[model samples]
Target chain A: MAIFVNADTKVIVQGLTGGQGKYHGLRNQAYGTQVVGGVTPGKGGTDVEGIPVFNSVAEAVAATGATASFIAVPPKAASAAILEAAAAGIGFIVCITEGIPAQDEAKVYNTLVRDYPNTRLLGPNCPGIISPGKCNIGITAGEIAELPSASGPNVGIVSRSGTLTYQALYELKQRGIGVSTCVGIGGDPVPGTNFIDCLKEFQADPETHAIIMIGEIGGSAEEEAAEFIKANVTKPMSAYIAGVTAPEGKKMGHAGAITSGGKGTAQGKMDALRAAGVKVGLNPTEAGDLMAEIVATLK
Target chain B: MDLFEYQGKQYFARYDIPVSPGDVAYTVDEAVAAAEMAGYPVVVKAQVQVGGRGKAGGIKLADNADEVRLHAGNILGMDIKGHLVKRVWVEHASDISKEYYASYSLDRAAKKHLLMLSAEGGVEIETVAVENPDAIVLLHIDPVDGISLDVARDAAVRAKIDAEAVEGVADMLVKLYRCFTEGDCDLAEINPLILRPDGGVHALDAKVSLDNNAGFRHPEWEAFRATEELDEREQLARTHDLQYIGLDGTVGIIANGAGLAMSTLDVVNQVGGTAANFLDIGGGANADMMAAALGVINFDENVKSIFINIFGGITRGEEVAKGIVEAMGRVELRAPIVIRLDGTNAEQGREILANAGIPESKLTSKPTMLEAARAAVALANGN
Candidate 1:
């Protein structure tokens, strides 16, 4: 019912021996992700928190039939790990590392998009994508996710910023508006899937009645997506773009936040989205409330 | 990591791409000797980190040692695109029959390797593409197969180069790919890839950007790293091993989260203010870290106000508050500081800040980020 991940999805943990990978793998296992196995090369044949460790993703895939891979390797080695997972026929590769050199990711993305046309990549610096109520394949908190059986679905959430996703979800939860699937697409200069890409999937999901998209300054991706929304998106959506008054020329936060000399200004994106019939919020606080109001109004 | 022309040319030479004989000089005397070594009619090129040096007269052809001295003297201290010229590249001037352009860089936004080639070079290729879109050949190289010989040939043909010349251009493109990968360059460009009257492709100018992540593998780059000049705040951030990019705003931001910090900027901007810098103290923004963040922001004269937005998770809010309290003891603040504390031990953190009476009028405990941002913006504007 959800896109990209579900209960049948067996997962492999790349860099499972490392602190972050092991910690998250255990937590992910606790959340019922079916963390089938892991890959740590030298630390193979070992088990971290009861999850079997293997030398390579291929071994993990061959033995456990792990469909998805959660990559927690450092920035420099992230792309190589993604290529390894893709080559091994892992269905979804989620990269959690940040500061990946733009060139390296570009090379990795270009190759993956061309060679493994069917395989999907979630992030290089992104929070791993999740299909709530089915499986948690990424770095999103298990406690935050409300299952479909436990809580009825209302909206599909797609956000570039992970923390904002959590905050907005918390707000939605308080209002008793549970998510069908919440995707933290990761806020990197080059994300695996953009707002438009995620929108199509959310729109097609029958459980998802409305959509909420969180964005940041820099890049015309939002503007481009707004154009698509105007033409295609029938579902009502509420949006928030952070960094409204960021210094004119400074890249103060994320790599993608560099204003690109004002090409993708927050205000400019807000205006476009507004024009496209998306309800623009004052901030994250207003985003969920406004979205809930809009959804109710639509009902 | 953007390499100057001289440094880029060195890498081009490694691939056996033809480049005029050249040497880099840090002084006028050294430049004069390099011109002598290159043989006269030499080009005295200003070694700055920007393009358009030719129009700025940062580049000049010198026929003799006297001319080299004149050009190098004028260029050595000249400023080009905010970069002060401390060195000059003296090289043999070329005899150009035609000018073409080529570049390979990561189109990160698109998540692909972008290949741009143009028949019209010697001028800004961007201008050519903007004006005559058809004149420029844009190619997105498949990350897997890479820039194949056939694809390269196709690009060359699209650039309007003759079929015979496509073979050579294709070969050069392959070599350029090697330089891009092997050199760990984010960008490799040959502007004015000249077609000499003798019928050969010669790279008359080189623009390259070495990936900073790969800096560890290339020790030869250590010497070149010395030439870089960063501002005081950036230098401080480098010392702390923090990722900080300075801005020209008044509201200095210190937040536990990157997304929150960015939203803080948005909040500040929405309320009609500007955030001076983007400073993520990471998850470890304790007192010492707080002190470090304060120290870095305080150094910036542009930072008239400060905003601290923290959403404590595994990171304790009380510990963050203690850090800010301690930091206030060490550094005298010239600008107002706003602290929007939330999450675990948030009330306790607020209590600690309140007890210190660290500008109580300036210290408003905001319930939400939006309110805190509005207050900070108002305070920054002296409302």
Candidate 2:
């Protein structure tokens, strides 16, 4: 019982004719995702790697009855693609394109909240989500996440950065722990989802007994997540925040990973998570070990 | 992508928002000429991105050509809060009747656009937000619906703006919103949206920050990029298309992702070693990319040792190992290198590295991030 996606979830690819779309679409298909069809504006009659192509999302949805979508269009076309998917009534959408202007994301997000309340948008610049051994969406390498343990998936993982998401999952796998689902909400300043949003889902999933959250400096999202965890979450959580020694006012690669004017420091996030009764690890391996301990005690 | 005062004013003018007539000048002679054209009494304002220009005496009033020359001479080449003044904006001074504050920015928590308006202007908005929170009227605008005339008017009234100035303020707000959206700006701010003696409202100062992600839509932003000032190492990294930040330490750290790169820095510090720089080679760590990254790190004289931490997901460990070996042949290094390889065929990658026949004095490998950090730190400290 993973959140958002599972074995029966059928998916569609947007901009599937493009290089990135075709590459990851095949990968998602190989990972056992039911990638039914793809959408390309001009090449409607063609098929990409044995997947049927339609000119519009509506056509693809009607033809294949796909419930989820993966967007791999360029930055300029990303907002329109997301809106089209939402308008077509796709329940879940994950956008993997980076460098979409913040203004475009803001507009798309506002529309999603006000007009299409049912649709859940995952990322505009992220690696996307995966429910291990069931389904894979977006560009997370499918091989790293181990198959579910015989006890069923016990831990849920959420992160802002892509590689760290893979790192956390790999570490947990080494400890003989399997995941219910892992979501990379992205490192953009205005992401479609936040830490709290994923936390809420993890709490509701009966299969997820504990959670691991990977955060970094910049924005108050981590601090806000800590507040939500203290109030709502009953599941034990372990956390790690990167960039403790990162200098202020300099962007650390990721668009959203910057320490501003004494706020959004790593120390601040570490303190907030600790106050929420979550064990905070100084690094990735340490955090995975802490979560492994929590999973070990879950009878 | 922070715009200087002159550039911000230029952007405001594009939206037909009222701003004082101003021209940028790099020299005192140009300042005097601009003052003559604008018809003094003029204001000589230093062009620097940092705040507190006034408190630092970067702003001065010049009633004549001689005063303009004197002030401009003093202000140019002056250091204002560690930012050197490279230019000045000469403008015709306005007769201010009142001051108000207005700005539009993204509210990450709310996932919406935030509008801030205050009747108490000409001061730090942060101070106002902290001391008298209610004095500043906050409005969340839906991006699709935008701000209606009624909503804009309500914001002005709630800000305690004078009755006569409300209409003009609302009009300015609407124009500012257009500027913010059309201009693809993350922040469009007017510190002192001043009211003139003759019942005219104008933008006295402009502070804008454009989203670099939106560069594709606005090709004109190339002008802004051209004016950017970067240090030697930063310029080199920019040329190589590597995400690198220079620091004053001995260990040069490189990783595949931003989060891992930052974590590498933290782990190095935890092991009693400081990082010379932060470099993210990104997802594709092929031979060419590794060579470019290594070249950039070698240019930093402060670096005594280098750490390459790659946890392959989309990038395979064997490919990374080959890239490192190939890169070693491309560049001669001043600092010893420590490689930590993990994920996706890691054992095969380690075997490849072991059989490369590289000297242990110049190259060493560790299996874990912690051990790699300790080795790099010890080597950097000349242990």
- Model number with the top DockQ: 2
For candidate 1, lDDT tens digit of each residue in B238-272?
Answer: 78866677877888888865677787777787789
Candidate 1 per-residue lDDT, tens place, A135-196, comes to: 88766666665554333347888887766766667667667776778887776767877788
Candidate 1: stretches off by over 4 Å: A6-10, A29-36, A58-65, A87-89, A114-118, A130-134, A142-153, A171-176, A246-253, B80-83, B108-110, B162-168, B256-259, B282-291, B312-336, B341-364
The lDDT per prediction is 0.79, 0.91
Q: What share of the true interface contacts does candidate 1 keep?
A: 0.48
lDDT of 2 by residue, A148-260 (tens): 66575488999998778888888887788888899999899888888999999999998888899999999899999999999999999999999999999888988889898
> What does TM-score give for chain A of every model?
0.96, 0.98
- Which DockQ values do the candidates obtain, in the order shown? 0.47, 0.73
lDDT of model 2 at position A153: 42
lDDT score, candidate 1, position B69: 84
Best candidate, TM-score? 2
Model 2, runs deviating above 4 Å:
B316-323, B344-357
**Chain B global fold similarity (TM-score) for predicted model 1 against the true chain B:** 0.87
- Least accurate 10 contiguous residues by lDDT in model 2 chain B: B282-291
